[model samples]
Target: MSKKIVIIPGDGIGQEITDSAVAVLKKVSDKYNLNLEFESHPAGGTAYDLCGTPLPQTTLEAAQNADAVLFGAVGGPKWDNVEPTLRPEKAVLGLRKGLGLYANLRPIKVADALVEYSPLKEEIVKGTDVLIVRELIGGIYFGDKCESEIYEGNERAWDLENYSVPEVNRIVEFAMQAAKKRKNKVTSVDKSNVLATSRLWRRT
Candidate 1:
């Protein structure tokens, strides 16, 4: 059976890169004799300009129905001053939240051909590869009761950082497994010496 892949050619350079990715996928499909179908959808600032909403219902429905979604980057200087709730960033966040994509995997790799891309010395950057398995949905980015307040000539603001045991455990298990697959070492970074949440994270 053909696999359905939903593509969102979002904003700015998205069109350029998305086309390249699609072409590569198509070539691979033809070469391997794999059944693959692609459905392109609009999202982000472009969608907002066309449909008056950053995340259109049609796009959301398509993504929900598709087997997998290939996304392009969103947002640009044109939509920089837009309202926070209606901004292009909101569209990406909404998709992640709606789809329940909790973990964020960022692979930092230094390519031999692109050695000059690194700010570090050639010797230090050579063959330096690392995987950052971040808990995307449960950190300060998604915390509740976050707001600023000012009253009586005094200003105060607080951003809550809360997490459940299950959330932490799941992320840790994933990170450990990822580390085991590579170096068999996991270096956990946190402000455990100061923050209460970090303490809890360490304890858990």
Candidate 2:
């Protein structure tokens, strides 16, 4: 059976990067006989220009059904003045919501050969391996907000930050399981002193 990979090349350098990545995937598929199929979908400012929405329904459906999605960058100053809902950055948020994606795992590892390329000192950059697990599709990003409102006769804009125990527990459990596979350590950060949500998160 062939596996379909959805490619979402968003604005800016997205096209160039995804094109090169697809070329590499093609070579690897041919060499290993992995039977991979590639499909391109528009998103971000490009999509908004062509379809009046940062994330088209077709693109979201394709991504949801694909075996995997190779997503490129999104957002640029070109679409900064657009409506909040149709902003280029909203494409990524839409995909996360439509695909039920909640975790963003970022791995930072310095290879022996690339140590010189790092801005950090050689001693600090060398032999460094770290995994930063971030929770997406929650918090202020998905919370309620007022783009503009009147409070005490003053124009105000605010975004609510919210978190539930279950939501916190799910991500924490995932991080714990990930730690078990690595160094058996997890470091969680939050501003519990000031924010009620963070206090709940810490307690959870």
lDDT of each: 0.87, 0.94
TM-score of 2: 0.91
In angstroms, the error of model 2 at 136 is: 0.5
> Model 2 over residues 1-204: C-alpha lDDT tens digits?
899999998988988899999999999999999999999999999999999999999999999999999999998888889999999999999999999888999999989999999899999999998899999988999999999999999999999989888889989999999999999999999999999999999888
What is the clash count of model 2?
0
Best by lDDT: 2
Residue 105 lDDT in candidate 2: 96
Per-residue C-alpha lDDT of model 1 across residues 1-204, encoded as one tens digit per residue? 899999999998987899899999999999998888999998899998998888998998899889999999899999998876678877887788778787899999888999988788899999988999888777676676434588678887666788888888988999998988899988888899998888888988
**Backbone clash numbers for all candidates listed:** 0, 0
Residue 87, model 2, lDDT: 95
